[model samples]
Target: MTIQVLPEQLINQIAAGEVVERPATVVKELVENSLDAGACAIEVELEAGGLNLIRVRDDGGGIARDQLALALTRHATSKISLLDDLERVASFGFRGEALPSILSVSRLALTSRREIDQHGWKVAGSGLLDDGSPQPAAHPPGTTIEVRDLFFNTPARRKFMKAEGTEFRHVDQALRRLALTRFDLRLRLSHNGRRSFELAQAEGDTARAARIAAVCGDEFLANAVTIDEQRLGLRLWGWVALPSFGRAQADLQFLYVNGRNVRDKLLAHALRRAYHDVMHSQRHPAFVLFLELDPARVDVNVHPQKTEVRFRDASVVHDFLFGAVHQLLRRIRPEPGQHHRVEFEAPAFSTPDPVQSSVPLSYGRNVSTPSWPVREASGASGSAWPLYRAGFAEPEMPAALNATEDAPLGRAIAQIRGVFVLAENRHGLVLVDAHAAHERVLYERLKLQLAADGIASQRLLLPEVIRVGGAEADQLEAQFESLRRFGLILDRAGPESITVRAVPALLIKADLAALLRTLCGGADDAESAEHFNEALDAQHRILADIACRAAIKANRRLTVPEMDALLRDMEQTPNAGQCNHGRPTWVQIDADALDRLFLRGR
Candidate 1:
């Protein structure tokens, strides 16, 4: 091959290949152009899933007559002129290659009538980069671009296109993404002359929520949390679905930087970490978030498809995103009458109120009487169940909240099946997994203690010995300090043996010997020390195990006060909605729903 610069037509075709991967890509590029043209109302028409024809008509600022031909030329753009403009370009089609690229591989005709013009001008062409002199044509004030025979010049590219239905689905999905990101714009799509969907412009919180329901699905909105936070010139606003309303894949996760939808890994990683503890394993959280920041702080020209962006200080952005979402999610200690869509429809329990009354919760007796924490086995030494199990016997807790409205979990009414706690709140019925709730409470306490003065360690009556591989023993030594912080005191006896001198009080009953072996067995020495101490799932598993074992056992009887105390603790706990294992801690059945079930209204 001779060393030669590629011809303009071939170059444009290559660029088209980069952005236009399939019918969906064509829709994306064309619609992006329409958006950049300041289109408020845009209609996307497709035939044969956009393979045979794609027509995007928009009511916006249209190209002028003299510029009609220039619009078909590569690199000719009205979005940015100065080099600085490229750095802070706000428009979606600043590159200006989308038009010429699509024109190179397909038959393209652009017709537009500027606001000042009485008649429209049309420039029609296929490949050859020919501007083709504009001809006068009557058109409404706006722009209409007709693209036909996509990839006609390259049969191989057309062959890669999927079946009609599959392709249309892709196009539909793409349009939906755009609609969600640009809620202020009206977008409509039609396939084979049949209207697929038509979204009207959405304004205000209620209207935006309606748009979200229409585009992302009503189920998602029903189960999502609305977040609007602004700090240091960064604003993150949108809906994040509850952990229970997850997806099998990340298809429903839509993240837009400024106003452009992108797939930045930093943002994705932060979201993952935010939902890490609450989400079920292998499930992806669904969200439609828009992050707005100083345009100069983010570079949008990082990827060819413009689906990724680079932040000037990526770590700052990541932390801000993570903190905002993480804090909001933690603060979401369910409002009354509203449980996540995973189960029961109604308001759910929330945090505790400071107003307390000395009167005992009424489950047929005075909660003021200390009747529940009758220590059976061990006494003070057992912090696991050490000083009285969650009960009415609490001399430490001041008093239980009197009003049902104040007590979000409501006054505990009774215990059921030794596993669940049945309660009545202002909203309606609230059923709680006693074990799960206690487990979460204990887990949170343990973590807080771990963060504060380090978990209180209790010396074992007798040291437990464990045997492991030589490499495992080495790991045990390396992570000794890190383990010590979690209240694990270890000593390496030999190349394959170690002794556990003391354990966290909560884990006193756990099989320390076996658990130690598991923790040390698969230890990744290659991992960073910070990550090893903080992000290790194995470390969390150990704590979770301790909480699980220490939690109120199934089938145990409890007094109203004991149950009330547990509910109070749950109200104060973060992520109290779910247990350590991702199972919901409580479910709410609305009083209205209960009435409807019995036909009370009828």
Candidate 2:
């Protein structure tokens, strides 16, 4: 078959498959366009989670009447000039496919006017001919894009759409990611004609941070750590929240390459690696990192959606980011809050006599009191037994054990295991899993340290030499200096195997060869020495095994003072409520729950 060009409409629909996954996809694309247009103020209005309508109005450099038609044409972009421009692409809409792709799947309308133009023009779908030509009408200087009936022609796609509320949540998420990246830009969002959220334009970093807090919630801002660092000409600036501040999952974490929002495995790994040892296995850290580098150094044209990119020096960038965040954490450690210990006094051991006083108390007796005792016939004794009697069944009652106030909760009354300290509290009982408690306590402390002082590492007795395998080894050898800064001293020991002489003191007892091999084996294909070192540093910070060793063991009878100290320290520790394994360190039981269990009341 002879090769022929595909129709523009068909080509655009294909592109749409890549750029538009759902209503949120449309919102993301449109908002990115507004941002690229230098819009300081943008408003997004949604209906049916953008399935029925998505209107985006922006006060940016709007398209001219002549360019309005071009804007709707696939691959016709103002962002690029030649093939070389792909390497230096910076704008979020560099691919030039979003507009056309959006238009293909929906009834699209665009109204735009350049600031210089007296008025704007409106381009309607009616002008789109069978051959893909646009006829424009008159319209304003700013741009307003209206998309209606998304995926109407694609019934299969429509069928996959979730309920309206769930879909709206996705759209809300998309807008949030974009908004966080551009704090300087005022953003407004509404759903089905109702105002939901708005962010005022911010000027300085502080203002931007405050705006972010306003959008992401004040709790996030409170736990976030500011990062600012330069590596190989790349500048990293942004905030990363403490692990305690993260969502139940990683969905809340946002990353921006330059100013464009992106979700990439590499970035996520870097973040997780940064918090590896400092946080529990299930918990995640929230971060918003903006990487600024020369436009020529990165390749943003790798994908039409432009959400992922190829960095010129990815190893350097990864290390820079890991270090900056790691350092920020070290400087500002959030402190822990203290918890008070409660003790419950048990009843006396001696059983009381089974006797009922015949006389009634004048002070407590009520006028409705019965004149005689209510009794039930006893089957065996043929005698009346007081049914409503109190303290009358002495033979059936068990003797109570006495406890002294001076007795340690961890010794006389409770079970203290390897990492758990179980004790009886005032209301009921408390199980203090020490490892978990310490894990959470340490996590909070280390998180504060990471935020405040970055991570602290003890220098090794000798520099560790990690030999790489083949060409990868060469890459590592070249970035030796950068590796040293991260605490992985590497030198070419052999052709394939780098000799391990010394590792960071944090892993002195760890199998050095295995650790180094794991680091090298897991590295990206073209990772440099700097990258390996950064990875090693991140690995070093993970102190789960070590922390477990240092943490108090459960079942071990702790002295009253020790238990008191542990309780005191844990209460003061941030995030100490949960353990390193993501389990709660302690549980609360109210007096009502205990009384019900004991059958003490109705």
Q: CA lDDT of each candidate?
A: 0.78, 0.62
Question: What shift in Å separates residue 540 of candidate 2 from its native position after superposition?
Answer: 6.1
lDDT of 1 at 10: 91
Cα-lDDT of candidate 2: 0.62
Best by lDDT: 1
User: Model 1 compared with the native: what TM-score?
Assistant: 0.87
Report how far off residue 471 is in candidate 1 (Å): 3.1
Q: What is the per-residue lDDT of model 1 for residues 426-469, given as tens digits with 9 covering 90 to 100?
A: 87778899988888888777777766788888899999888877
Candidate 1 weakest ten by summed lDDT: 365-374
Q: TM-score for all predictions?
A: 0.87, 0.62
lDDT of 2 by residue, 1-602 (tens): 89999886778888888988899988998888898899999999999888999999999998877777788887788988887787677778876778888888888888887878766777767213233333454545579999999988777878999999999999987888888777788899999999888889888866887766766665566556566788688898877775445467776577888887776666677777766655666777777778888988777767657777777777877787777775554343212111212223322344544563343322211112111111221121111221112234423322222232221122214445455565544434445666566555544444444445453445556656645566656655666654444335666787775645443334455565655454454445443233344444443334333344334444455544344445545534434444555454654333544454334554
